[model samples]
Target: MLTISRTLSLPESELVERFLRADGPGGQHVNRTESAVELRFDVAHSPTLPEAVRERLLARRDRRLTDDGVLVIQGRRFLRPGAQSR
Candidate 1:
């Protein structure tokens, strides 16, 4: 389960994750590693989300939303060797 807040939590089944190759530095090695994560969440028919929250999410004009009311999020992770933590 994914905890969004103190009173909100989403089940793991509602979230789908797909690993894909990321386009960035690392030359030839970049194509071999799947560092980019594509996350899909079905907001139209989720049992976890409340009706009001679902409606609000669907009402958004964000481009990440699809016609079927699915939210698509792309996560790109990049790590540099010998890089210091902020």
Candidate 2:
């Protein structure tokens, strides 16, 4: 299960997490290991989400949101030479 808040939580089935290769200079490890996480949530079809929350989410103008009301979130972890990137 994925915890969204103290009162609201989403089920594991509703939240899909996929790992992909992160882009950056990290030697062969970067090419071999998938460090990027892609989280996909079906806001329009998820039964766990309330109607008001779903409507509000769909009403927002977000480029990550699809026409089908699926929210795609990509989190990348890349290695840099210094702390400048951080």
Candidate 3:
């Protein structure tokens, strides 16, 4: 969870997870597994985020989010299959 209220970045908390194929130097692991790097963020419901940040998120016309307002990012950029969850 990134804190736009006070910090430049934050870790994962209320993040939505997505697993997909990745392209990296993991030998056969790359082919047999998913390991790249991509993460999505949901601007809604974030804690203490700046108003401008919230507006930016709400401005995006992404359909990846659900009715509950959660954005999904495909994560495959790393040594594994999960996103960094930042």
Candidate 4:
């Protein structure tokens, strides 16, 4: 479970994570390692989210929110050495 706040938590089942090769600064291993992470959450259909929160999240104009209402977050700043495949 992922805790969003004192009262809100999202189930791990609702999250989808994908790992891909990250660009920049990993020496020769950069091309071979899937160290970057993309996390996806279905805000519009999440049963764990409150209706009010879901509506508010969907109403936001952020580019990370897709037309299908899935929120995509990516992290690529630091690469883990020898990160294994999922």
Candidate 3 segments exceeding 4 Å error: 1-7, 18-40, 76-86
Better of 1 and 2 by TM-score: 1
**lDDT, ranked from best to worst:** 4, 2, 1, 3
lDDT of 2 by residue, 1-86 (tens): 88888978999888899999888776757679898999999999999999999999999999999999999999987666664456
lDDT per residue for candidate 4 within 1-86, as digits (tens), equals 99999999898999999999888888667688898999999998998899999999999999999999999999986645665343
Each prediction's whole-model lDDT (CA): 0.89, 0.89, 0.60, 0.90
Candidate 1 local lDDT, 20-50, one digit each (tens): 9887875546689887999999999999999
lDDT of 2 at 44: 94
TM-score of each: 0.85, 0.83, 0.44, 0.85
Candidate 1, overall lDDT? Answer: 0.89
TM-score of structure candidate 3: 0.44
Name the lDDT value of residue 69 in candidate 3.
57
Candidate 4 residues lying further than 4 Å off, grouped into runs, are 79-86
Model 2 TM-score on a 0 to 1 scale: 0.83
lDDT of 3: 0.60
Tens-digit per-residue lDDT, 1-86, candidate 3: 55544555646765545556665566546577754444566567777456787777777787766556566665444544343333
